[model samples]
Target chain A: MISDSPLLKLALTFGALSLVSVGGAPAMMPEIHRLSVEVNPWLSNAGFARDFALSQTAPGPNFMMISLVGWRVAGFAGLMAATLAAIIPSSIIALIVGRLYMRFSSQAWFPVVKDALPPIVLGLIVASGVVTAQAAVSDTLGFAIVIMSTTIVALTRQNPLVAIATGAIIGLAAGRLGYL
Target chain B: MEQSADSSKTASGRPLGKLELFTGFAEMGLFGFGGVATIARHIIVDKRRWMSEHDYAAVLGLGQILPGGNIINMTVMLGDRFHGPLGSIIALSGLMIMPIVILLGLTLVYDAYAANPDVRAATIGAGAAAAGLVIGMGLKMGRALRLHPIHLGFAVTTFVAMGVLRLPFIATIIVLAPLCIAATWWMRKR
Candidate 1:
């Protein structure tokens, strides 16, 4: 029988994540890197990096990294626990924060929060992309993928989903043909 | 902060309220597939007309820089803009609750089959779709910003630098954003 301990760990990490991560998931990159790679023996940095890339390219959210971590640590059960842990605490916080923000929204200081938010978020997104690219975009094949994806994104008005679908189809076909 | 948008009547000629904002956020949470930011823009600018595309871009730019979820940041920006602090809270709560519920549901299915080909295929498809959505949002941001040729040049150059030259994302943004902003301001003045 599989244990539930990893899942609990995920929940605790995620809860702590929501509270401390002022700069977003990328801001927590150092800590996550430390935990997943240094403190814990669950996975190598490269393995975690691969999962991070997959999650970034995958649908849903970056937090899905937790699921990948869970999978590495404890298989499918770990995945569920990690995924749940990532989702729940932030949700509850959102509920309470949302309620409280409503109560004091009109106060003068609130706008300050609004004003401070944008630059930080923008910086983090760029940082997140950089971190992903550092790990994922290696050599010619990876570079080609990044270039093609960016060009298609820049030039086309087609739904972005279609672009990703196209890439996956190619990846799958390549994999099937033993090219990957 | 403009008078028109702050006090403007929506296309439906209905004044939006706290409930509408909450419901809107809930809907976004539920159906916001593929690059949450893209879906976010749709809900805020296109569907709800809660804010203009430009405003959305500003807030999105800000949210992306902060920690946590970009969509959550957008929720806060919108909530604060429209209804003050309480609205931000309502919006954030609505956005988060849906996904937690969905993930919990996923846990049940996950337990049933660890190596389900269908689930694997779906996630792959979803991943590809997500990449596409982000590309789409980049396109949308390009249009919404109505950047000049120079600004466009800066964006394209950075994209190539980041995507091709494999330049660091933060470093490029740091170096280029000021140039872009300066050029934009110069162009606007002319």
Candidate 2:
């Protein structure tokens, strides 16, 4: 039903996500996944997973997934709508809040609000990780790739691009072996 | 510290030109593959000397608390700081324009190649790694918080509700966020 006018749907969905996307783009992954895959059926689970992967591989903000989803659903118009919708609302809010904060930075309530946000944001990020991991990992090799990549990223200050490249190679090999 | 001081000495000590703001953020947008936060810090505080480290941190903190992408929010704030609404618009354009074009091009290539077995496999692998990156980021952020017991409890509850139980994101945030804030406020008052 919502898919009928996918451009409008894409704009509204992404715009809504934009406002609530505390901690950044990744923080809103679960909702993005839910809206795109489950509610709207814009992308299948695997398709959404693939788009998510592509977003990470592409340069720029992780929020690029919104653009990819738009492109997949409705071409260039959809992409523009989704990207602009996802960015503009929050950007405006930030401008207003930034102005206000600059004026009232020393107020007592400011630090309290600041102190409270990190844990909640952390939780949201962890939830997003779980959602993506569930979508991506299925087999033993997939599990291994996830674990290895996690270890590499967690233990070392290495660029995450290395882990992504390594995972791609491993997956290619597994695919050649018909294990994937 | 030393690097920051040296950069400040060399800085032109003028409000950034609109073009300069655009180019600076555009560079960060282009090369900020995994994330732009660190690169933004380098440009804004360490290299450009536009803001002190303390000021940058404060702005970054505010960005995190607000909605949308952190870097985008930072750009908005930074741009406004120098040149108000028009400056903010330029900063956002500079940050998004090149990357949008590049991503669209990549999307076209991806769509064309998506049917291939190799492409499928590579995407799967990259997806898994991307998931890992998310987890790694969560772990790092979680560790950095050094959460108090109450904060940990809230974090765990949030994880369970949102991640494990698959609760609706908006509802969960609305319910949990204010509670967490009140808890912190109480903790601070004591």
Write candidate 1's Cα lDDT for B56-103 as tens digits.
676565554344565666677667666766767787677756654565
TM-score, every prediction:
0.53, 0.94
Query: Where's the lowest-lDDT run of ten residues in candidate 2 chain B?
Result: B1-10
- Compute the lDDT of residue B30 as modeled in candidate 1: 72
DockQ of each: 0.16, 0.59
Error of 1 at A17 (Å): 4.9
Mark the regions of model 2 whose C-alpha exceeds 4 Å error after superposition: A1-4, B1-12
Who wins the lDDT comparison? 2
| Tens digit per residue, CA lDDT, model 2, A49-163 | 7888778876777788888889988899999999999999999999898888746577887888888888888888888888888898888888888888888887788888888
Q: What is the Å distance of residue A128 in model 2 from its true position?
A: 0.8
